[model samples]
Every structure is written in structure tokens, then in C-alpha cells.
Target: MASPALTPTTPATRDVVLVPPAIAMVWTGAGRPHEIVAVPGVVLGAGETLVAIELATVCGSDVHTVEGHRAAPAPLVLGHEYVGRVIEVADGVRAVDGAHVQVGDRVVWSIMASCRECDRCRRGLPQKCRAVLKYGHERIQTHWELTGGFATHAHLRAGTAIVRVGESLRAEVLAPAACGGATAWAALARADEVADVDGATVLILGAGLIGLSACAMATDRGATVVVADPDPARRALAVRFGAAQVADPRDVRALTAALAATGSPEYDIVLEASGSPRAVQAALEVVGVGGVVVLVGSVFPTEPLPVDPERLVRGLITIRGVHNYAPRDLDAAVRYLRDRGAARPFEELVSARYPLAQIDQALAAASAGRAVRVGVDPRDAHRRC
Candidate 1:
């Protein structure tokens, strides 16, 4: 679809700086692969900022979109995990935390942009607001065109909560904070409320980046984590991330049986981060009576498992479902990476790095379980870093 006429932007009470054109990777569909597209830069509109993305990571949901597991509009710029520097800031634009922002400040923002007046927003659930503009998740036919991080330059629209980042946070470690880290933080936030997360038996159902991030976060709380993954390599990484035990998902039945034999109750808290619907039932089986299970993954739809509400009632098991995250989760994600990034080898989870054009290969590596997460640098198409 051809975009309509471009609206002229007039900077508020200041001179507007025009940016130069840059390249971006636009998703065509599942048929072939994303194509390289040249994005023309324009004058900064009021409440919009142009950023140069330093690192954008391919999320599991991005892989799901390319593989047809998740439904997304075609021909959009499809990336969200990112860290970038502000090249231009529109007038009257302020961070969500009410701090003043300027150009050249390294920053990270929430994936979901919400209207502050919505009911959900008032209740502190911005991700589910009536009108939420999620960067990278939206179809690219709208204005500015480059809403995702796969591009060399992206436009930060109004309602985006911009937080200036510190040097203590590395791109690879902070990139996933937009989605994965915030997601894990949101899920664990609920788990921490009902149960004693510190020193509790926390079972994470996937050792992917989100799971590993949850592992690290749980470690900070003194939780004894036991992670489960079908991939042996992921399970190994879980150990390094402070998981006391790692089990294969295929052996969930056996693993649960072994736990039953111990006579101690099952896990006090279960986090489903595998993105597999089947893991939901497995999670039910593993969570102890009166324990809590937070569904953090399942961004893609799959076969439905039998849900027995009576069982939940009888077991007193609290099941919470976290879709995206509250805005506070984003703040916590950046803060955790800033404060405790060096304490753990969270950077080790960054397994593969590829240039923007090689995103297909990066996605392939992540899909094949060779890497937990992959990075894409938009400026250098040929270099892998």
C-alpha cells in the first residue's frame, strides 16, 4: 500500500533538524524473507524522536512470526528488542518518569505505548490499554513507517516512555529488556507477591533468554531455581545462570514423578516461559498445592490443553497470565541490568550476532536451538558482531 501524503513537521519553538535517509529490514511475509528497504528521514514531528538503533535482537516471537506460528501483518519492520541513541527529540517530549530528555542520550523504551487516560492505564496495565501502539509489533503501513528496531533509524512516537540508559548496561544484555526482560519481570512480580520467591523452589519451564533472564532475576532474590528445557545446551546454560536443577521438557512426567517421590511438595512457584502451550499443563502438574503459576509465554496460539478450574480451586493454586507488562516492569528491567548486570554472566546468554541483512540466519540459529538469542546490528550488513 502506498503511504498517503507526508505531513510537514514544525518543531515547537525551535529549529527542526532533518535526518538523513537510512536502511531498514522490512518483513514481507513467510514466503521468502525480509527485504532491505531504504527509509527516508524526515523532520521531527512534535512528540516524536528519531533514534539510531545500536542493537536489535531477534525475539522468540519474531521467530514465531516468520515461521507462521504467530500471526502478524506482513511487510512491517519486525523487531522490538533494541537499544539506541537519540539523534533528535521533538519539542514538549518528556520521559514517562517526567524527566527531561535530549539528543545523544542513550535510551530504551517500552514496547507498548499507551494512552494515559485509558482505564487500563489508570489501573497500571498500560500494555492492555484500549489503544496501545507497540513498536515492532504493529503493521508498518502507518506513519513514519519504521516503527521497529530492525531499521537503522526508528521513530519514537508520543506516549513512549523514554528512559536514559547508563553505560553499565550492554546492548546485548539490555536489548531484550523491551520485551523479554520486562516480561519476565512482570511474571515474576506476581509470583513474588504470593509466595516466598527468595529460597523458594522456582521452576522455570524454558531456558531461553526470557527464562535465563528470569533465572538471573530469581537468583538475585535468593531463589533456588530449577529450569526445564528440551534443549540440552539451554539446560546447561541454566546451571550457569544459577539454576540448581535442569530437566528436559520431554521428561516432565518423570521429573514430576521424581519430585513427588521426594515427599516435599512440588515447586512453590512455576514460570511458563517455553512459549509452548503444552507446558501449561506440565506447569499445573509441577506447581505445589497453594503455589502460584504465572504464564509468561504463549504469545503464539497452539493446541488447547484441558483446563480444570475445579482443580485450581481445590488445589488453591493461583494461576496468573502476563501478556506484555506494566510500564513499571520496563523500569525494573533497565534498573536490574544497570545495577546487577556484572554480578552474573547474563551476557553469556547472547549466543549469536549477525548484521541486519543476515537476520534470517540469525533467526535460523535461534530456531535450531544453537543460540538462546541473536543480535542484529542494522548499520553493518556484512559484519557479524
Candidate 2:
């Protein structure tokens, strides 16, 4: 006879089943604190999977929602950057590599779950599908209350691109790959499509998680990278991540001098991840003729940036904006982290950690701008920081 199927009560399954009353932190609005409450166990749908969140990092976009910088559905679960272990897999589910998803597998999923038949999906931009269901941005519903990483359990819905990660990878090193790392990969991929990244002169504005990841990726590809950020700590961190030179974005002279020292006086590729309007303007100005500028930030509302039509015509510059990320980008991100994470200071990118119940402190640490990324330990949901 065939072996019996493993039950939820199995010792191995203990990793996914919380002690009792699975809890989640609910973000009510901009100025209010999160509410800790028990959430029901997930009832997986067809092609869905249930994962117990191992570690979740507070992303800048999460801070934006909490601070009212961006508009999102009220009372949502506000986290997207995380890594988890699979608890249960529904029928007909496969990973990005076309392998069947199994229980007890460590995984990271795409930020946005898209309907494959949508126009954007058909056009090769599934990240922007009309029926996209963003994990952290969705409203709470009875059927899908555990949609975000701030919770102990996330119900991975159908069409969500899941990639199985290695069991050996540290949670902190893998969490940011969901958003910051993947988006940066998407931006660089765009630049590579326009101009080869190898031996390219690249300028990355913003030394935060995305910026620092881009810096490391560019340098890994043989590019001479210059990173600009207002934070001294982040700049120092960027150097460790493989930036050939670092500068203060606020100081135009320092930026200009760095570019001149690069021997080109202009960047072949400029990646803007700071979300600063001035930085966006600066990216356009410093990019060389036939250069490509990939804007990976600026998700929030900002003042209109004035652009000169004559400059675009004369410089032959290309400007592209990358939001969330494509599935292929997420695939590349996981592989990159799995392969190069040990060589670079990728683990240093997550500077702080807090238990899920101490989410307020976690968000505080994240918003304080001192940490590249702050993590939340969902397994310690009831513990102190």
C-alpha cells in the first residue's frame, strides 16, 4: 500500500502551525497603530498555497502607507518583503521552475499576483495586470485575511509566482529579494536591454536597499559604479556592497566631480531609487548621450519635474520606470542572492529585527532611516523585541 499522507499534526508540520490563535497586525490607517488580533487558519483554494512567514522586512513603501505618503486600501496588511516556508500546497501548483511545490519548502513569491489572461500579461508585463492582486496592498476579506507578510500566515493565491529558495539561506539575506532586490534587478535588466551592463559606467542614486543592491549587481557585472546618498551610514554600506565611489546627492559639485573622475563626465546608465524629485531631475541631467536612465523609485506622489524637450532630442537619452517587478526578475533575484549573497554584504542590508507584536517598534526603526531594512520575526509574534 502507498504510504499515508502527512497530517497537519505531524512534528514536521509544527513549523507552520502556530501554538494557537494565529495573529496578524492590521494597519488601520496613516496615523494609527496596528491592531493585533487572531486570524483564522487558511483554507487553501485551487492552485493556492499556505506559508508560515519566517521573516518580514518593513519596506519603504510600507512606511509610505503608514505615514500617509501614498494612498492604499485602508485596514490592510502592510508588508510585502518576506520569506517563508510552505505549510500546505493545493493541487495543480508549480513553482517558477515548473517544479511541483511541496510542503516544508522555503519560498519567496512575487509581490503582485496577476491574472494570466489580462492585457498586460499578454503583452509581457504581468506585473501590471488589470486584475493584479497585490499582496500587501489588498483589503482584508473573510476568505483572504492573511494576504500580507506582517501576518504569521500568508495565503498564496493562484497566479502568484512562487519560487522555491534554498533551506540554507538566512531569512534576512533572502527577505528583501521579494521587493527591493527584485525591483533593482528589473531596473538593471532594463538598462542591460538598452546598453550592456558589463564595463558600463553606472550611477545609482540612493544607497538604500534597492540602490545598494543595484550597486552590487552593477559592480558584479564589471561596471564602475558610483553611489550617491544623503546618509553617511548608507554610503559607507554602499562601498561594502561594491560601489567604486560614493557621494552626497545633495552636493551637485561632489556628484559632478565623481562623474568627471569616472573619465566620461556622464553615466552610461543612471538608476534612480531615491524617490526624490530632485534626484529624478539629476538622473536625466547626468546621463550620457545614448545612455539609459532607469527609475525604480518614485512610487509616491511628488511635484512635477520639468523636462527639456530639446535636451532629450539632443542627448538621445532613454528614461524607463520600473515598478514592482516581473516574475522573471524575481527568479533572477533569488538566484542572485542564492549565488552571490555570501560574497557581498547582503546580510548587512537588514540592520534590525523585531518580533511581530513589536511591529510598532519595527516600523519606527524602519522609518527612522537608520536601517537599510528592518525585519519582523513572525514566529515570535507574542514576544518582545
Stretches of candidate 2 off by over 4 Å are 1-19, 382-385
Q: Write the per-residue lDDT of candidate 2 for residues 1-385, one digit (tens) a residue.
A: 1111211121222123445656789999988989986774655666678888999999998988888888988778889999999988876789999999999989999987777776788898988877778889988776567879998888787788899997878999899999999998999999999989999999999998899999988899899999999989888888899988899988777888988887765789999999999999989888889999999888888989999978888999999988888888999989988888788988877889888988888998999988889999988775531
Best by lDDT: 2
What are the per-residue Cα lDDT tens digits for candidate 1 across 184-227? 88888989889888877788998877898899899888887888
Off by over 4 Å in 1: 1-19, 257-264, 381-385
Candidate no. 2 TM-score: 0.93
Best-performing candidate as measured by TM-score:
2
